[model samples]
Target: MARAFCSSDDEVRRVQSALDEAQAGRARTLAAFAVTVGSDGAVAGLLGLNEREVRVARRTVGKDDAHRVAEALWERSRLDRQPAPQDGTPEPDSTAYPNEAPAQPGPTPHVAGQAGEPESSPAVDAVLTGAWHTGADLTTLAAELGLDPDFLAARAQQLAAEGRLTPTPAPDHTGRHRRMVEGPPPPADETTYLHWHQPAPQSPHHQHVSWEQQPPVTWGTPVTAPQHAWDGYLSHGQYSGTTS
Candidate 1:
């Protein structure tokens, strides 16, 4: 029994050694094919294995699965290297399998405000023109220009400072009265009065009246007729001594 177990172990080692040699040879072949065509990812996808598994299969020995992966990679490389159809049509055999032929990448689509392209120039011009002629604020102009309001406001301020654009004027608040805090009413004993003062003398020949020396004549104040002779001459229907 001991001799038989030893013989079985030796046979297993021999078979494993043979598999290691075959796997190493297949890995070398697959590596060459991978260099010629696509990367480990493409080859792994063709073999239905993940990238890590494919890499491990390439390195580790005694893996019959690696041989199968190697064969698939070799075939894929040959197909990729084949000449394109002369008539600009896809080769019939190339489309036999879904992923047999890699699709040619198309040009990327353009996005507004992309890094390389300058989209702000025309936008800034439109905003400035609208602001100057229409007197529209940054929020309204941003909506019209389809731009960010904050960005538009900042740009508008910069342009206005540079004298490239005129900023919209702030709304007038002159007549808009705000509510004032009410203070305590005036003292009850205090009397408020409206007074009418006498007009200055209009004639150059007459002496000028100095109003600063006279007290203001209130509503109930009395007036006496002038003693001068000119007072009768000056008394006309239009002239009234009483203050209205």
Candidate 2:
């Protein structure tokens, strides 16, 4: 006998209704041979399977066929509905689903060489130099050099926070204590000045004698470019000058 299983309009509800009718041994909307095809290609409805048998198999029997029927009914119901607005306001070059907004790119950091303002500064140079040459922490180095630790830390932290300095972690309490990590060296207060070596002048090996008893002698070729020359001189193992 021909019977309407379930229509797309009310596929699931209709199938369930039929199942109920069959279980109760009442009139069934779905026939024994009628079947429903879901949007996903699952099959619902029954053919040759009696009402009571189908009910038992689907409800009490818990057969896979019952599950297939439910899935089929759902899928077919969704597919049979009117086509959704495939192209809202006419499709653009790109196809986007309805209710979806265009994607936006994230903001990028302002690089030094780019059109943005220059990021280089004397403070930044000092922090970087301290970190490289001495392997010192930014905050500790700045403090040791009598600089504002906050300002120095900011510059160094910028590089670190940006993941550029992934090799080095940020300065913490531990890093601050590392200021003295260089270890003890010769004290700067030592006043002893002893001459180590002197290069002969390219000239006639000029020698000058003072008439004054034990005339004071200048040291180290009279150091012309004296940038931190005093510190450099002090660092020398032996310092030499007229011991007046």
Candidate 3:
């Protein structure tokens, strides 16, 4: 009889398959253990344990080694047909728990448009005070702040609840207009002008803000007239060589 010899390639493939199966088993065991531990034993984010600590914990199981322990317990329970507890509550299934998320620290506060950092409470006040006078409506204010109007309104409502802002009185009993309260007084009078940018369009909602009306002013700031005064700039070709 000829002796049978296994090829090296076949042996290598067999070993690789075994390793793959083992990894899959370990993954399943870990999943089961995580769920079994429930919220109390589940730690948020990655375990900060060092390699040596992890090795020791793996050998001598601790609270953090719930998955491995759960796997062993499950195997014994299934093999022995262990009696269920009298209370009839099911033992936790570690497989159900998801990987914990990383912890987030508290918010970082700063002033907006200053040093390129978002403004904190005081900075928010300063920006708003300088932003609109004749009291800007919430939508206009939100546009100036580069935020969505609805988002700004929600924030405004929250602030109002906290006594930081006040909701404007209903325009009519029927509630036609919904405006936010005026922000804090500016450092100077509201009439004082800052550099006027190009006039915004005069839509029906914005008609009150017109060229004849002084540009909206912040408190403590004097309105400065533009150097070249023109009511409205006209195109050059539009007026070319036409008799007066």
Candidate 4:
């Protein structure tokens, strides 16, 4: 019995803007899902997104049931790619008949529920385990695996740090060693810092989250929730939050 209505041109414009934003977000999310299943660099390049954005989208998707939906979609695609008798189509001839044409082997397509090594990336991967061939050119290996050498090296190091990978005769350590560590700029001289209105430092919880996390901020702190809330709102946290 009710009809939707728009009040004014401004309201219509706002609705249209919101819809546009929603559509862009949907595209980004789908691109991110594609990234999760062997399409990382391709989807990232197509959508003009960097690895962090792709990873963030993937993590966001994992926070809900959407990841399962993506996995289902992958399975469906796998099924469609396989030879099957669907829609009354004839099943592929797998038997070696005496007179039939010999099966020509081509690059194998990726298949789920199978143990076959993928044609795209070699299955016997040892880069992450720090067991790739000694004196092997990892940059070339990364290219072959469609990965960045830096990332491969970093993951191996991380795994080693976690004691999951053994550092056998160590690979060459390069990138992280070269990165510069810069501390914050000098604190604008104490007088200038005092003159400027600085936001009170908040516990890490308050700025980014709301609802239960807001009242929820102090759940881990020894201080009471009221005290935490009071501290968070009273410009007591770090001097970075926007002021009213």
Q: Which has the greatest lDDT?
A: 1
| C-alpha positional error of residue 200 in candidate 3 after TM-score superposition, expressed in Å | 99
lDDT of 3: 0.44
TM-score of each: 0.23, 0.17, 0.19, 0.21
lDDT of 3 by residue, 1-244 (tens): 1223457667889999999888655545544444464432342234443444333333344454556557777789897886668789876666565554445687888533335343336655544434322344544555677755444333333444455443233223221122113344445443544323344545875665453464343233332221011101111212121121
Tens-place lDDT per residue, model 4, 85-192, is 567766657574556877679998856322532322234234434333233445556667775554455444444455554323333333332322222234467777
The alpha-carbon lDDT assigned to residue 156 of candidate 1 equals: 46
**Which lDDT value does model 2 have at 174?**
33
User: CA shift at 43, candidate 4, in angstroms?
Assistant: 3.0
2 versus 4: better TM-score goes to: 4
Q: Model-by-model lDDT, in order?
A: 0.53, 0.43, 0.44, 0.50
Give the C-alpha lDDT of model 1: 0.53
lDDT score for residue 165 of model 3: 40
Model 3 / residue 203 / CA error / Å:
99
Worst 10-residue lDDT window, candidate 4: 215-224
Q: Global CA lDDT of candidate 2, please?
A: 0.43
Q: List the pairs of residues colliding in candidate 2.
A: 32-47, 39-75, 39-76, 194-239, 194-240, 195-239, 195-240
